[model samples]
Target: MARVLHNCPAPAKLNLFLHVTGRRADGYHLLQTAFQLIDRSDSLDFDTRDDGVILRTTAVAGVEHDSDLIVRAARLLQQATGSNNGANIAVRKNLPMGGGLGGGSSDAATTLLALNYLWQTGLSRSQLMALGLQLGADVPFFLFGHNAFAEGVGEQLMRIDTPDHWFVVIEPGVSIPTAAIFASSELTRNSKPVKMLDFSGAYIRNGRNDLQAVATKLFPAVAEAIDWLGQHGTARMTGSGACVFCAFETRDEAEAVLASVPKKWRAWIARALDEHPLSHLQ
Candidate 1:
């Protein structure tokens, strides 16, 4: 009998704060950000098949199969591993794309991790992370599977424990192109680094996303979302984003705001998870 695979979740992430410290000669921006996992997630299921490598899509509505990162990651892994075994992959998209949730990247990382195990590739975590970085800067961090402090084009990661809390994430139904925000001249390219302890004390007051101002100026929806959420509590962009989030002491408090969220926007109440969704995997 063929083994039946169960579902594996790929959770979304929120950047507590993001600061651009400098730019490298290679054109990559040096960044400082804190990544915190959320309860909200996308899920994937896999079943091995004798066929070479086939990608099956179960993407969210309006997401094209050809452009889905999960499929691309699967194909990339198959080619890179030179493995004869292939699996049928199905994705259940729950998180929004271009929302600064790192949904796509998380899905890709989950794919690589799951396939590595199921296919008996026996790749080490570091090896998988190295492969993941080629897919996206955020991919490596997701593979690390814990709250992290990231730097160096968002590739360098240091695991950290974040205060536990619930979050109200609001998406203003707009997609901000990350590349456009990164390329904008208005982005703050120089920022002083702060130690993790400094952030833990008063993250909201001291931490900031240098790209937020630039993004808000270009996308009023982002500004609107931030402004709306700020009224309830501290609100900030997760990354180069269209989604803005705020922390709440309780799920009920977060839900209260989620209920009042403007109909024109999208909102979710999520528990902040200290560990990454894939942390349990060997």
Candidate 2:
């Protein structure tokens, strides 16, 4: 009999703040950032198939069938567990790609966790997270199952408590490639590192993203969005992004700001989530 899990939510993450401390010799940038889980999500449905053929049955525009993270994650787990089991995967994409919301990584993490259960693979959470790392740097953080402070190319995670808040996310209508942002000579890579003990909820608004300068220069819409949102609160870029966000004390406050956004842009009012929606599932 086939097993099914329906309406699983792969929640997006906001980089409350991102700092580049240095670049490794291998060209990977070392980062320090806090990942905030949000209610906004990409919903997924998975059905196990006894035929042992992993496939993404739904269409995601601009994404190739084999190139989809959901497909890649399923295949990786299939190989890891030596399971012939397969799945019919459906991704209902709500989050924008390259918006720095970690949509794809969250989807990939959900795939591994869901497939492990459906396939009856006895891999531990740690094991699943390790496999997720091979897929993307941000994947393991989702598997970590909580708001986290991340470092070491975004894989090293320490779960943290964040005050519940609402966010006004302004999508700049441009896709800023992370590779180009990181490769930019103008990007700062010498931010002094700070420890978790140094983090405080009171200072949330004081945090900054070091990549913002370069990103703004490359994608002017991002800069414009940031400037507009700043009128409501402290606006900053999330990850290497075209989407800029500002935190608000309440949902209504966030929504009010969202309402004032220019008609040309897209915006959302999302509440911060303390834990991943799938935390209990795993």
Candidate 3:
């Protein structure tokens, strides 16, 4: 029988608040943020092959199959485990690219996790997470599988419980390149380092995104989205964002606001998730 895992989900994330706290000599900015999984996701399906040939069976516009993170992830896992097996991976991409929602990173994490199980490679979760980091900083957090307080280039993580809040997310109709934002001289890389307790306390729902200022300034559509959404609640840009979101206490509260958002921008509502959907994969 051909082994197959179908409809596996790769969920999106929201950075409740992101702070650039420092810089490394290597040009990576140190960070502090909360990672919240949401119901929104990109889905993947895998079918094993005997020929040891890995391939993506679907097309993602503007992304070459060989260069896609999904393909890179599968090949990386095969190398690490010395597994003489490969699979045809298909991705149903729902999340927007470069939206600061961790779409690509989450997709890569799912690939590592699903292939690990399908290939019967018994790697511990921590080992998988370490491997995930080589792909991207945010990749490990998806594999961490919990709402987390993240620091140090967004890789260091510790689980934290988050309230089940409803969120209204708006797409600002522009794809903001992450590298351009970080390279801006206007970006402040000196936010004071904060402890987990600080995130737990006064800023639990009140924290700010240090990158928001630079992002908004660079992308007016983002600023317009944030300004309009702010009327509903504590609206903020999630990452180095082109999407802005605000949290509400109830789904109704979120929906009501969603209804009133200008039709020009695509918007939707999602509930907060404390754990990744694929967390249980060994």
Candidate 4:
């Protein structure tokens, strides 16, 4: 009988603070940020296939199989290990796409870890993380499986301990394209960098997302969501744009604000995770 790993969680991440330090000649924007793993996630079920055919049995709307990060990660690992085994990957997509929650990247990271175990590929953690980087910048962080202060093009990670706070994440009902945000002329390319010791837990209240200004001006809903969430506490855009979040000391406080959120928008309360669910698996 083929082995299977069911209901693996691919948790979303929040950029507690995002700063663009500079831009490279290759056009990759240099970034400094703290990635906070949250409880909210997209789950995947991996069923082993002995015939050596990787397939996404369940489709995510608007994402093609060939283009799906989950499928790409699976195929990448397969080729890397020269493994004849395959998988029927099914995803229960919970995180909103293009909301800056690192949904796609987390899914890809989870796939690599899960498949490596199921296929008995024997790839080391460092090897998997290197493979993840080829998939996406955020993918490696998910594989790192801990809260981190990241720099460079978001590949440089230094593990950090973040406060245990509950967050209310609101989806602004609009998808913000990361490329468009990064390419905008109005986007701030140079924000003075700060050291890790300067990262107080309340940094999000004082710090900013270098791309938020550009995104808010481009997408009014993002601004509106920020303003709305701000009513409860300090609010900030996580990554590029669209979804905004505010932190609270308790789950009740977070949920209370979530309950009052406008019905037109989608909202949820999630606790910050100390590590990725697959941390033990790795």
Q: Assess candidate 1 and give its lDDT.
A: 0.84
The residue pairs that clash in candidate 2, if any, are none
Index of the highest-lDDT prediction: 4
lDDT string for model 3 (31-81, tens) is 999899999999999999877799999999889998999999999988999
Off by over 4 Å in 2: none
Whole-model lDDT, candidate 2? 0.90
lDDT of 3: 0.91
* Model 4, span 1-282: residue lDDT tens: 789999999999999999999999998999999999999999999999999898999978999999999999999998898999989999999999989999999999999999999888988878999999999989999999899999988988989988899999999999988999998999888799887777666665688899899999999999999998999888999999789999999988987898899999999999999999998884
C-alpha positional error of residue 2 in candidate 1 after TM-score superposition, expressed in Å: 4.0
lDDT string for model 2 (128-191, tens) is 9899999988999999999988999999999889988999898899988899999999988999
lDDT of 1 by residue, 1-282 (tens): 334356899999988889899999989899988888888998889887767666674546766776777777777777888877777788887888788899899999998888877777777888888888888889998998888888888888888778779999988888887999999988889898766565563664468888899999999989989998999988999888988999988888988989999898878899988777667665
TM-score, structure 2 vs. true: 0.98
Evaluation by TM-score, superior candidate among 1 and 3: 3
Model 4 misplaced regions, further than 4 Å? none
